[model samples]
Target: MNAIFLMLMGLGAMALGYFVYSKFICEKIFKVDPHFRTPAHEMQDGIDYVPTNKYILWGHHFTSVAGAAPIIGPAIAVIWGWVPAFLWVVFGTIFFAGVHDAGAIWASARNKAKSIGSLTGDIVGNRARSIFMIVIFLVLLMVNAVFAVVISGQLINFPSATLPVWGAIIVALIIGQLIYRKIIGLLLVTIIGVVALYAMIYAGPMIPLALPDSIAGFSARQSWIVILFAYAAIASLLPVWMLLQPRDYINGIQLFIGLILVYGAVLISGPEIVAPAFNNELPEGTPSMIPLLFVTIACGAISGFHGLVSSGTTSKQLDKEPDVRFVGYFGAVGEGSLALAAIIAATAGFASLADWQAIYHSFGQGGVSAFINGGANILQQGIGLDTVLAQTLLTVMVVLFAGTTMDTGLRLQRYIFQEWGHIYNVGWMQKAAPATFLAVGSCLLLAFGAGGDGAGGMLIWPLFGTTNQLLAGLTLLVITVMLVKKRRPMWYTLGPLIFLLVMTTLALLTQLKSFYDKGDWFLFTLDLVVLAAAILVSLECTATLTKQIKANKASPATDQP
Candidate 1:
């Protein structure tokens, strides 16, 4: 199929799913009544539950959903073939991701604006709440760790790129502080910030820094740990408006512009889809279809991480009625579309099947970073831009992307820790100081200990896929329970839930075996950690459902006549 045709098909499918499928489910079954005051409406605190304009909320939702995972997952999935990757992106977004995101938003809206963990407790059981917390905590840890590695790797490869990134970040911080906290004039600060960002990008190569010879030996992996811990510390200490919000705004704009340019170039250059629609030739013992493809492409289609963002951060900031579906549901569609674009770019323009394989083999091992840089080179050559400069620009862009995600992960981790403190009745530990310390300390220790050398090692690399997929599995389980509780049709939720459970379980087992065979004790230990958690979560979910069913049976009928 032609590029335009594919793009249209993918987008149309998502739109149809959103408007037709999502609307029917919400109206007929879940019966979301926007006119009815939500918890936020009843308790308008202006702090967390304040009503917000849909447009402003869109900014928040889109920024929260758009992160490093979309890029990484699709890029990696393309290793299987663009067909499987593309189909997953299309079908998963329509059937799975949209439902997951919409369900999370609606569920949150119905629950007095509570976090997903709290709702899981109310709808499922108290034990499920604890399991949800633990699962989300682990997921956040992996997010912070992997993104730390991602940013550090880019910075190491292109030191010059840091100038524009830091400049943009500082500008964003100032602007965010000004607008949200009214520390300064919003108009003046944003104008200055934008100008500074542009100048920094234009003059990026001119900046220089001296480094010791020892720095040359620094592992990208080790640098990730240091940078992550240090940033988490600062993020915890600072007000969200000053850093996180503004930073995300700047990063979001950058992401939008960069992606536009990328697709524009692809269109102008008329790059063809060079990879086969399907790679039916499987090597011995290879699993190309079904479970493997589904698990491998988890993020591109549906992700549990989106639920964390939706409930933890975005929902709290929601300001208006119409904003929920626009920000929450549409933003998810945008992210899925971005993944589709990346798959197209990666698979297009290669000379032959062998060339496609060569490109994939050469850059696929390093994950999204490798694929992004490689794809940038192709676009540059195809569109006649300077290869070196184009590659450098792409590198910086991705670093900024990863930085935004890590920032969110750090904040979420802090909140999770503080909540845990409250749950444990450690009132003294409920303050931001201890929570911030633990969050930052945990991230740094894991990042550093996962691989002392900055190279990120194999230990941290493989966990990205497994941890992310496991989170998706957990999310599906929770959503399924919510649907059952709401008396919605069980078939839709149950089908995907069961399918994802089996796929994720097998994927986890595969990862455990790979870890054991490689003799990587650290990853092996992580596998064990996730495995134990998975077992407990399964038991909790099953037990909770059983109780609910029995309770329903025992309840007396109101009037039999």
Candidate 2:
């Protein structure tokens, strides 16, 4: 297929899903009542359950939904060609992600401001609640660790790109704070901020702070992991308004602009999709397409991680009843569209199928920088631009995308640590200082481990997919339990849960085989860690369901007395 056809197909699929399937079918079946008194309305707390405006909530929800996972997963999925990735993303978002995200918001709203963890306890049982918390905590840890490495690698690969993106973030935060909170002039602040950000982009190469020969040996990828951890530590401790919120606002704008540029390029160049549809065989020693494709494109289609963000943060800030559908369900569709855009962009650029295969073989696993440079060179040839500068800018854009996600991950880790400490009655963790320190320490350990090899290649990538899918499976389980409790038709939740369990379990087994085959003791060890966690969580969930069933049966008789 050509780029134009693919783009049209993608947008059509999204529009059909979002407007028709989501609005007419799912809403009618699920009976989503916007006027129902949500938790934010019933229990109005300024801190957590405050009702927010739709526009501001959109900013928050979109930022949280769009993260590094979406980019990386789709990028990897395209290795199998844009066809599978594109189909999964479009269909998955329509059926699974939209449902999951919307369900999280609805569940939270019904539960009177309780988080997903707390809701699990009330509906699934206390045991399942504990298990859910542990799963989420580990998921956040892995997320923070992986993203830190991703950003650090980008920074090192393209120093020229880093300065402007970073500068944009810094400027955005200051301007956002001054305009929104400090009551400064919004129009002037925005204008000045945009101009400054653009200026930094042009001036980035002229800046003098290049990596030294000795430090440069650290490898751009490895250094990023450390830098990511350090940045996370600070971000976790700051007031959300000061850093996290404002920074995301800025990053959101950049994301918008970057995406527009990419789409414009696609339209201008009209590159054909050169990757084959179902090339005769899979990559060497690969698993069959059935489970692997689903597993590979986990984030693009339907991510359980989205549930965590929805229930943990976004749901908490939902100010009104109607906003739930837009921010939760629609936001997911937006993310799916972004992933689709990436898949199209990657597949569409090459001159011919042979050229595409050659490029993929040479630099596919080298990371995003290589892909961007390769794509930039293609664009330079076809569309006359300074190849070096375009590639540098592309690198910076990728890094900034990864960096924003890392910041969110770090903040989440702090919350997870604090909550875990509180649940266990750990005195030290009850204090902010101790919790922050613990979060930082945990991230640092992962960073160091990920960076152990000089190349930082193939070290963290393998772990990211399995752990991510497992988290998604766990999220589905929680959502299923909630659906059952709400007395919705059980099939909606049961069907997806069963499908996810099979896919994720198979994916984990695949990882185990690969680990054993490679004889890499460290990865083998990590595999064992993940397997144990999965088993424990499953048992906890089973036990909780059994108890709930028995309780429901006994309740009717006791009421007769």
Candidate 3:
């Protein structure tokens, strides 16, 4: 259980998945045709649709999908045991998430870069499609609220990070302007931005920016959430090139530096994972680890949200069909790597067994803080940085990840609102400001209204995991239907589809039990809604598969799409 050994094993397994398992998927299942003219070219409009280089697309896709969930999930999952979490992250990323992500891109690219929400109609019929869209809308809404709280939580607890984080945003806006206006070359601007960001990280501790506890009785956490959403409302309305894209590029580089630093720290510090191989000390009310762990450690292993990202912006920008495996599949493995690092840092790098245990004791409220503390330990011990500075840097890193996801989630929600507006014949909802307000307002209400504990994101946070995994299950269902229609070898998708459907359903059921036991009516209602959606999806997917099976049996001439 050495940290270095776990790092090497986890990363090595992801590499094997990418090289070996993904190769099998590419050749046999997808049969990616380099010659296939991707929709990026066929449907080029220069606005929403354009062919992008694979690497740039990967950066967009990777940062969009690699958010706090990966960090939070495994950091908490290690409470069960490092070994179970490790196995799931390595294998699940390869087989479940990797396949789902790549398949989503492939499905959408073939059909003209339509989103998973839109594609559901074609693959699963109108009714199921509508339910699926509702699921996506709900997922995105929770994402915005939850991540707002996540970043705000970091700001509340780690005030030293505030300067560097807000500083990075200003730098990102400048980077956006410079890169867009051609005042400076892209390569040089990026380098300058990264350098400036690191400098802010170093200087942040000297002038920490802390929020006051209350403003006219509004608590600091609540106040930050409101401000963050207001910022998100504007950020979502702006063009992607102005702020989103530039900042994402910076985030991608920062992520690489983080991974390298943590791994190097593991080597230098030589910490061993002191947590048990199979932890049995979880709190009494905690659900059994089997299905819960799979859903809990979602993004690191397999997630449905990646499908939204793959289909959301990445599909529109993808340059070629063959590049899908690299951007979609490999982006997933990249997240798995981040999650693995989180697991390593959480279980081993906390400096003492008692400290790690203390973090887990209140993990529901403070798991992510534990992750930051563990990572900070590595930075201080391995790289000779001041402990305060180290913690500040790591906290800012997590905040950037959360911030990007929040901004992007708002944007995606806007698109969903506009899309649904058209469907429902609501003309005003199709416009930018109205759509943006609706998206932002919904998030604000959810963040502060129903779920408020005088906190930004605490209310909707619990439902995020189950909803996320169920969304993945729903997306896989869509993919399976798409493959069946194509008459392609569908075992690759169908197996994962079945697995996710069962796993998510079990988790949802378990959650419902917990909600009912606690008499939490609001959460109980929402979980019931999601459970109903799952049932609808399962029925629709089952029917589609049955029809396809019977059709093939009825006629040998009909082939896959």
TM-score each candidate.
0.86, 0.87, 0.95
Off by over 4 Å in 2: 24-51, 112-115, 182-195, 206-209, 215-224, 362-367, 374-385, 450-460, 539-561
Model 2's alpha-carbon lDDT is 0.66
* Residue range 323-352, candidate 3, lDDT tens digits: 988998898998999999888878886767
Q: Candidates 1 and 3: which is better by TM-score?
A: 3
State the RMSD for candidate 2.
Answer: 4.0
Position 508, candidate 1: lDDT: 72
* Candidate 2 residue pairs in backbone clash: 51-319, 52-319, 152-224
Which candidate gets the maximum lDDT versus the true structure?
A: 3
RMSD of each: 4.0, 4.0, 2.1
Top-down lDDT ranking: 3, 1, 2
Ranking by TM-score: 3, 2, 1
What local lDDT score does residue 380 receive in model 3, on the 0 to 100 scale?
77
